[model samples]
Target chain A: SAVISQKPSRDICQRGTSLTIQCQVDSQVTMMFWYRQQPGQSLTLIATANQGSEATYESGFVIDKFPISRPNLTFSTLTVSNMSPEDSSIYLCSVARDGTYEQYFGPGTRLTVT
Target chain B: QQPVQSPQAVILREGEDAVINCSSSKALYSVHWYRQKHGEAPVFLMILLKGGEQKGHDKISASFNEKKQQSSLYLTASQLSYSGTYFCGTETPGGSNYKLTFGKGTLLTVNP
Candidate 1:
């Protein structure tokens, strides 16, 4: 199991602004995942961040709107750029150690874009 | 495709039981169960990796039927702490994908 922590537990931002959320893991992981949960909705995978390689994004989510950076095995950052009211949601960082099926998640950052 | 969970919401009194079901149209390699309380991240409960497999932890158990591409979560003698939203995530038939498409979730409210 991995222990993860995300910065800015909750933030209220205005539209057109950008917010960068940082995720830190206690141990090295092969991959880190960014997920978004809209109000009263299920989690949607935003991207898969792998160290030294470009992040893999899911359909409907683009790098221009949500830029991801993985500088090392234990750290990653996701930036929600040009935010809008529709971007208001909870962002969670999750990590699963290689060879393990269980994923551990950090306390999510709740962003309300007004 | 995202899995579908039935009984969008359930209300139960403490000590009662509840079951949550998740089904998918695509073949699955694994099914993961998670419970999330308000204002918190979802916590992993268990994962079923094979057909007709059942796993349990302290009265909270789950079964996966690979043939049907469906899974069920059983919470027996539910406690107050069990009040939360439950989600089932399914991974398509590949370990390499590592991407899980989650269900809409089932909201379970346990009244005292």
Candidate 2:
């Protein structure tokens, strides 16, 4: 199992502002993913942050809107640019350890756009 | 595409049993189960790979029918701690096999 943590556990940001959430893992991981859970909705994948290269984003999510950076195997960051009320949701980061089939998640960063 | 989960919500008493089903239109290589409490991150439950496998952890178990592109999670003798939203993530045959496409989720409420 992997232990993951995210910064800015909860925040209230004004519309048009930006918030960057940081994810760190206790151990090195090959894959790290960012997800968003809206109110009364299931989790949606934002992008997969790779250690050295560009992140792979899912459809409906663009790199310009949700930029990601993974400088190393143990750390990554996601920036939600020009947020709107619709962007208000719980953002979570998950990591898949080197030899594990299961992916563990961080506590999550709850964002409320006002 | 996202998988579909049945019985959007369910209420159960302690020691009771419950089953949540997940189905997809596309062929699946694996099915992963996870549970998330209110305001908490999802926790991994179990993963059932292809070849029609059944995996279990503690009082929880899951079966994947690769041919049917469906999976079911069984919670036996459920405890209060079992109350949470359960999600089933499906992995397709190719392309980003490690990435999971999650279902809408089934909310399970266990009361003492």
- What are the models' TM-scores? 0.96, 0.97
Docking class of 2: high
Q: List, residue by residue over A1-114, the lDDT tens digit for candidate 1.
A: 778999999999999999999999999998789999986789999999988889999999999999999999999999999999999999999987688578888899999989
Q: Report every candidate's CA lDDT.
A: 0.93, 0.91
Best prediction by TM-score:
2
- The number of residue pairs in model 1 that clash at the backbone is 0
**How many Å off is the CA of B75 in candidate 2?**
0.8
For candidate 1, write residues B38-60 as lDDT tens digits: 88889999999999999999989
In model 2, the Cα lDDT at residue B92 comes to 89
**What DockQ do the predictions score, one after another?**
0.90, 0.86
**Over the stretch B1-112, how does candidate 2's per-residue lDDT look in tens digits?**
9999988999999999999999999999889999999988999998888658998899999999988889999999999999999999988887953788899999999999
Residues A12-48 of candidate 2: C-alpha lDDT, one tens digit per residue: 9999999999999998888999999985689899998
State the lDDT at B31 in candidate 2: 90
